[model samples]
Target: MPTWDNVPKGQMTAAVLTNPGYSADPSDCFTYSTDYPRPTLPSPEWVLCRVHAAGLNRAELRGRTGAAPFIGEFIIFQKEYREEPPKILGEEFVGEVVEAGSASGFTEGEKVTGFLNGGGKAYDGAYAEFSLSHRRRLYRLPATTKLPWNVLAAVPMSMYTAWGALNLAAGLGERRKKDNKPVVVLIHGATSSVGVWGLLVAKDAGATVIATTRNTEKIEKLKAAGADHVVLEDDIDTEVLKIAPDGVDIVVELVGPDHIARCANLCARRGTAVLVGPLNKNWSAGKFEPFYIPPTRNVSFFTMTNSGPGSEDADVDHPTVEALLSDVVHKIETGVYPQEVVVDKTFALRDIGKAHQYCEENRAVGKVVVTVP
Candidate 1:
């Protein structure tokens, strides 16, 4: 065993969900425990990391509130709530490798950032002093990058989801490569972290990006973040029609299922509308009719977790995810993508409940992060 510093004999401090159910106040569900068992490597592909910072996602809030159907099932079906230790919730983190298995291809003290399907049986998450991650789930940060741990922590999940939604699911990259025509993209909920990243990515790809935000205060910020035009969410269709005339070539729908019809209608003929996030906390689209989606346009769904190892399509999708992550890191390093634009708030790990509350209230314009000190 490698000698580890600041690690207790077999335990570590972590913010855990003592109860997995809805609470109007997020603080009621989380507890800080000093004796939470340090997760061990399950196999040679996994490594233990000392988490420096973690990024909060809306999914965690949904999962905590029992709104996430799959995550809730994973926790309840595993009987995690009835167990001695409850579940930890987090998906993206920046940290250092403290212990590595041979196949993990990482050395002790190597700085890294990663995303995992946390709050599951395989391993706990990054809302702790320590986290466990598989080698494939991580990206080794370049030594010369000037980004901080909190900013780096904000990148993995949001960036991966944005890139996947656009390139893999919606074929933004392929379309850009094949057609010399200008591509117009509409990113709904563009003030959210993933929406902002999607705007940046589409802009970087030379698209004419029109972004949407309900808050008028975020218009200038969205423009600064590379939105060609920013419109109020209430009148997006009217305003966007004024800009594009024939509808946009792609629509990144981060709002929720309830708005899929509007998103599909906004897509140009033969264009795609990719559903990336549910910022509105609405999961179901009841009483759907196929006519709601125009035949000339397409709608697709994307989730980063589904591409991880062991998923049905992982063999085909995982490698693409790895390449995309490395490419994103490279872009950040080269100044092609801005890192500072994505992080809106930082809270200490001890203030996790407050962090959750901040995100749940939709108060953050970008990513909300918690640093572990």
Candidate 2:
């Protein structure tokens, strides 16, 4: 088996995801190790990504209370594709290409990361410090941005999600191009990583963005992040009404269908509500009074998962993902991504359970990344 210690500088590390199984927690789900073969390496459809960091997404939990990293739909392999089991589990990651395929330079010692499809299953992942990626699934990290392990690792999944939902899934501004201004926006779960990027996008598009959160302490942070108004997620009427008496043009929802009715009510004549969060929870919004929409409202609701269709584009087309990768590297090099106090607590990879518990408790904020040395 190959080890990273033997790999030269500008060489690649062999990685692994171990003994996958169905579980309710990641403690039972993931195993990270450097002991592994280089496989056949990629003749094509493969690039060796020298991972700097990997991010964790709530989606990784698969409703399992952080007990397990998610594995996508299983297929019984036939002649069309070769299948392997108990592989590495990860979707979004930031890394560098230490080697390239036959085609071009989305490879070869270039800092990079993106959304993964076969990552934890038929492919390798970032937990082990190096991984493999199909060329289409990765982007080169900007030379100007320097990323710390945690932010660099986490940014790909969350930010790309924001790009998919805000820009593509709901077409947040497709019809409003004629207007001198950007589309007016409402972003729920403002403090969440994806929510923050969504707000940034709306603000960048020149919209009057309204963000929501249940935590009052984050109001200042949300405001500083460019939210025009920060409202409590639980309280819809008073705060949202005050912000927009008529309605808002776009709503990027992360809390799920529980707020669908409120979102529907506040949607303007032709607004859109993009649902990118979990919807299986107890989200009974009751019923609406009027089933038809004529002179009143013409809102559209959509559901998007990172799988299916052009979802793979999160690795390719997201401008913010590029920015995030660049910014992390820049911060690492020039020191500029805002070092907001490392808090009173830090942990090692062995204490992953404690880290998950701490984060789930929501006792702290400002990034919690496990340092694996």
Q: Point to the candidate with the largest lDDT.
A: 1
When summed lDDT is taken over every stretch of 10 residues in candidate 2, the lowest stretch is 73-82
RMSD of each: 4.8, 6.6
**Each model's TM-score?**
0.85, 0.70
Residue pairs with backbone atoms closer than 3 Å in model 1 (clashes) = none
| Cα lDDT listed for each candidate | 0.76, 0.55
Model 1 residue 241 lDDT score: 94
Candidate 1 lDDT by residue in tens digits, 223-284: 88888999998888699999988888889899997888888888888889987667877766
Please report how far candidate 1 places residue 147 from its true position, in Å.
2.1
Most TM-score-accurate candidate: 1
